[model samples]
Target: MKVTKTSSNITYDIEGLDAETLLSLYRNMLKPRLIEEKMLILLRQGKISKWFSGIGQEAISVGVTMAMQKDEYILPMHRNLGVFTTREVPLYRLFAQWQGKASGFTKGRDRSFHFGTQQYKIVGMISHLGPQLGVADGIALASKLKNKNQVTAVFTGEGGTSEGDFHEALNVASVWQLPVLFCVENNGYGLSTPTNEQYNCEHIADRGKGYGIESHIIDGNNITEVYIKVSALAESIRKNPRPILLEFKTFRMRGHEEASGTKYVPQELMDMWSAKDPLLNFQAFLKENDLLNDVDEVEIKEAIVHEINEHLEVAFAEENIIPDKTEELNDVFKPFDYQEIISENVFEEIRFVDAISESLKQSMEKHDDLVIMGQDVADYGGVFKITDGFLEQFGKDRVRNTPICESAIVEAAMGLSITGIKSVVEMQFADFVSSGFNPVVNYLAKTHYRWNQNADVVIRMPCGGGVAAGPFHSQTNEAWFTKTPGLKVVYPAFPYDAKGLLATAINDPNPVLFFEHKGLYRSIRQDVPKDYYTLHFGKASMLKNGEDITIISYGAAVHWALETLKNNPDISADIIDLRTLQPLDTETIYASVKKTGKAIILQEDSLFGGIASDISALIMEHCFKYLDAPVKRVASMETPIPFASQLEQQYLPKNEFEAELKALLAY
Candidate 1:
């Protein structure tokens, strides 16, 4: 390849790139520029609700996208309209997305640039902006594992660099030597805050050096420089498989969105950047080089304007689809296959912790695409030693230890799931999920609903209190995830159920929050099957049968119900252990409540907004006529679990539950 040097001695390869490719780059930039202008007119006319202008920085998106191969993936930010246009997504589809039509990628569920599509190999960013970096790590990881030789280009703004995900994604990608290009388009301000207020570093690329990643700074106004540098870097990464952070020094000519005007930006600065606009500079370059003259420039822009007008007419004529009740409720989660396993006489008495280990081992043996990740999960066997021997058995590749980055790993799991890789993420302590809350609720839980993508990932949460682990470590936070629509919450009481439900959670087509009570890890034991077996979600296990009263609970509280029933032998009650909290097994609860005519819901989580509240309301709604008395609930006190044993004992729901159970029975 022949290299050409600029006056500043910056080199770019020009021989290998054809004239058609060069002209195509100009065309790509022109499409978004024209579309943005038309969309601004629409915004003023009330035809579209919002627009994130890529007016001045089209070179960055177009350059990076043209650099990447079609098979490779690109996770774009809000101002990356050039990426969508260059990728050849239909003009009508883009218009529909902007107009919030059902024909759009998210089916009118989300607005501009907030949706991802597998069809175009484009993963869109959530409003959080940072998690997509980690998601890019996962996509690159999948590509590396599959030997696809594909490099993922993930874009972020200067403000997003302040996010923890940027650090986490860079660190992991460098450590793993995955093929990822972290592109930062520093458009001077994040919303209204300037780069100076966002970070202390001089350049965003400086942070990547701290993560041990190779870093670069480019003249983003010059499309030739961006395309040449990014293309070379991407190709090198594809061959050598590593991460590089490139800071594209560009400017956003328009406001953050159409509604937010550029009043905060200085007039002189705006004029200075406008004079160096990427479209004008690139067009001038093409003309100077005799690649594109006045006629070519006018014809190219005219064609783009005509195309935009044609697409707008069609999009305006199309009717918007509003989802009805059934459509709205359905499609949040993909269907899970329920398989019942017959007893094979092979059984071993094992503790709950051992059953968990056995379940993971069996599942790993079954699924080749399955990966296990978390802090100290590889060699240290995790904090509780549940994976004590997994490193030796599964190898470092399968049983990988991650940095102490809860948010990034969770989003990475989401990224992996989109590529058909199933991941089991162990939150060392369930309380740490607070750090990953945004990714779980916003990204993982909502991705499927937005774009019909399956998040085939399971987050194993070691939750609940009884062993005096205090408030942070010991928390029955299943209710938090149960409230999220796309997530499945599973909490098993016995060793047999733990093993079986885990297998089912691993196989489920959506994200499952599998809660494992640390207190019950060693205390509970059962004759769990030696062979692989799967249980079904939305199904409750009938522990003991009675007709006097019904006890409803899950997790460690299910054991409490069992112990309470055992102590009060005179109280004949149907003990319903709800293995899955989200699905609720409402039918079983209703059946047992109708049969017994009395019910008491139990939980280890505090009373306010507990899963018990939902179950209680459900029983009252469905089993009202069959009840002998008003349904009662027994839950932990509305306070953080204490460190002292006595305070913890007082805070727990065991005694309270027993009392509530007896009172409901007597009524």
Candidate 2:
């Protein structure tokens, strides 16, 4: 390792960083402080609605960030002015962002400092707490596996130290030995509660020791110490990818962003710390060495002030505000391309579970950007061994086996994608998707809007009922995620379609949630393409052509539809398999029902609001005249999926597939 470990107690290193660096540190601190002070005044004067201040802890951002390469990624907390400025974001951009101008990042939807520049390799700054730590973990892990030379810096507060994400990220980072710099700005408070209230640990650096990674506690106010220590830390992590903690002992000078009225902070302590501030301290150190004089100081301050106002002038003068529609919409999921865009799918005979596994193998072979992570996904070859041989074929690095932390896994996917790496996240079971919902729904779903960014992050899990999976394991929670717009939901019923749909979902420009139903993993066989191919979303498959009735279904229900047609030839059937739900194939459904003159929606999920509801609603309005009879749905009764074998069989859409057809035949 090229990185030599430094002492924990050391607080200063005078020469590794020289006069120019010191002045730059001083200049960096002053600019954020000046902008923050100005923005605070703007908020008070009604010129700006709100702002968060990074007043006291400036040196950590300045020192560590200045030492890093331009291509390195930075995942920052809310109060990281020095780090943000260090990453090349102009003071005016920050002001413009605070003022809510469209020219601002994300064309004005996100606050300034929310999304990092793609050109600069700075990852988006998420507003939510704790999760970004795990996000940073994923990025570093990607770099480690892909052999990329970039390092990632993740910021969090002492309060976040108590969060599960914080601990999970550190554990994963250290275990994987990922190149990550975990900077915890312990500004003595995690909001109103003191560090003492949230944790008993003496220092954030101490927590790193528990993970067996290198750690340091520095005088966060000292520019030289922060710079030299972090440079050394970054060097080691970059080479060997181990988690490192750099805890800056600083204070949050201003009250937490909007909830402010300063009386709670004792005046005397504030005044004392104000006198020893980072900018003033760095300036004095430079002057003592005769590296900076009165003339340079005056020019630097003037230049920064001029830049802030110049950006603000454009920000205020530009009438670029996002419209009300985009405020609620935009970048949720990449829009789904309908049927016309699909390359034809080639069919081959194979079992469904093996079909699902083969798709995983094909994707792993196809894209350098594609990656898979989950428990038993490696040597154990996955619980069902669908991902078996992947670790041997692609190596353990690519087919990663994680320690069963769903939130961390999902957050890592978010962070990894932020760095331009497309990820495929898997859980041992679909039931486990609950653990990852916070990052999936709150962070990943709203990320682009919140950060004003774009990324293609994918999550695939085995779901649905039947096969005696019981309550916890067999779940069809597509409704839970289908409600979240940014995520693409897919359910392929046959071997041929599974291979093609999985390929299509992988290529989508937005986050996709592929629902690989456990029930149909290997119920039967079909001809799937031996070569690579794709199937577009918002499209459906016509299983059999008929005139009397249309059976609309997905997942296992589609198979049931085919079985029903075998028993009843009198009722001619047209079965449509809805591969992707969110961007549904309404056109195909209506067209099929129009021709058939009657329609039936079938699903393996408990009735109310399933894909059947959405599909049936479209028919009642658009295809009513085409329908000779009322539309019907064959779905599980409104009850939890049962555990008993006989009840479970009776509970699902089995006999109904035939019964619905017979009813249509009678009509």
Candidate 3:
């Protein structure tokens, strides 16, 4: 393709030339520009809180979107107003979203561009810029695994290229050769941080070559050029899957938001770009080629203005659905039909680690779309050999070994889960989860509440301090995630509970943090059911019953409590093992505490801000009348786990639990 420039217009010599398509492109670009202008007016009038304008970059968004198939997925950023317009998103719905009305896509949960329509195959971006790129990579992986001819277009800014997720996503996409388009809107500045400050590279596309993927750069202001180039690229990707990074060099005319002025931008640079405005340039081209008459242009503009006005009126009349306080707890976990079973046949004996591996194998066999991904998980069988022989059992496609990028691991799972795939991710150690905490807490935990979407992903965490594994390798971090809504935290001590709970977590429709104590990996053994079985979350297992005192514990602490009970046979006490943390089995604990009239909560984490504190508070509020003594808690000291075996032994609360139980009984 070649471009010819005349005094009044520019023309392109493309194979499939049609006047109607060119007019539609101009019309699409104009619609978003007008809507953004209206939104700015609303922002000034205090009708809307803020506005992120896509004034001069419409050509890039509209051109790329028009090239994509309707069924293909598009994960858009804040400034991709042209994307929504090209996808035929109703103008009124966009207005209602900005107005924070209940009828909006997010049901008034999220304001601004943080909303997406599942029906349209669009996933909206959060305030964070880089994680969504990894999510789009997972979507493309899902499409490739399912043998679907679909492409996922992910948009990001020039500043986003600096994030670690950007590199991680690009590497994974290229390695897997998935059909994904990394559209970088290089507008020169990332919220006042110039390109020079962000990176030393000359162009963002230069980084793509290092990842072994093809890269291209184009003038973002030219509509016909972007449309033709992206269209051809999309077709090639669908035919033979692979990732391609495209850099659209454009400029943001307005500031980051309406409140922020353009004072930071140099006046000379602004003047230089203003002369090549995409809408004006495209209109001039249309007029010069005689493709659009003045009357046609006027009619199109009038139609768009009328439609936007009608939508605005309707949206303003609609009521905002303020969320009720009670509804906050709802939709955190999807409800499922569960039944308890008593097996008649002899159970198969297995170790804790083997049971976990077996459960993963069973889940993969049951669901073809279920995928297991982590660092060294495929051929090496994970860091702990928990996934041994998984690659041969389930091919490389289902069992993927990812790079040492924790954020991308979790975000990609979020992406796959949204596209009808169940993902199970393993953190090498629970302590290392801090790297991916942003996506885990902000994105995965809130997706269901914010967009009414399911994040069907399970993050396997091997936690707790024991066997002298220092601070980095061992830590009981369940309390950190239990406070987060939209996540289910499950910790099992017995092999039976570990296997059954893993199955339930894999099947649950919400994100789950499955904590497996590394100390119990080979040390514990039990008779697990050979057939498939699921253990219910938010339920406590009463190991032994006594009327004196109730000892509540989970994970490795449950075994310590059991051993304490065995040593002191005369001190009769009831033991309640909590299988799940987030959905605390308060009902069971309340009943046990009422029967015993005394309670002792045990944990292996630090004494401060542990799950035991939450349980102690619950006992005080619900079972205070029946309590014969204050609910005691036995937990590790408020310090990091030591590397030495003796110090590590003292660091845990195993020995303290027995003394606490004896004191509770004596009280």
Question: Which runs in model 1 stand beyond 4 Å of their true positions?
Answer: 1-16, 343-345
Clashing pairs in 1: none
lDDT of each: 0.88, 0.77, 0.88
TM-scores of the models, in the given order?
0.97, 0.91, 0.97
For model 2, the run of ten residues with the poorest summed lDDT: 1-10
Residue-pair clashes per prediction, in order, are 0, 12, 0
Instruction: Report how far off residue 549 is in candidate 3 (Å).
Output: 1.0
User: In model 2, what lDDT does residue 231 have?
Assistant: 83
> Which stretches of model 3 miss by more than 4 angstroms?
1-5, 8-15, 339-345
> Can you write out model 1's per-residue Cα lDDT over 226-287, one digit (the tens) per residue?
99889899989988999999999988888898788899999999988888888876676667
lDDT of 1: 0.88
**Backbone clash total, candidate 3:** 0
Tens digit per residue, CA lDDT, model 3, 1-667: 2235535333444347587788889999999999988888888899999888889999999999999999999999989999998999987888888877877887777888897788888899999888899899889999999999889999999999999889988988888898999999999788888789999989999998899999999888888889989999999999999999999999999988877878899999998888878898788777776777799889999999999999999999888777787665675556656655444556888999989998899889988879999989999999889888989989999999988889988988988987889999999999989999989998899888887888899999998888788989888899889989889999999999998899989988889999999999999999888877788888889999888888899999999988887898887778999999978889999999999899999999988888999899999998899999999988998888998999998888897777777767777
lDDT per residue (tens digit) for residues 393-420 in model 2: 8887778899878888888887777766
Candidate 2 segments exceeding 4 Å error: 1-13, 266-272, 322-348, 448-453, 624-631, 653-667
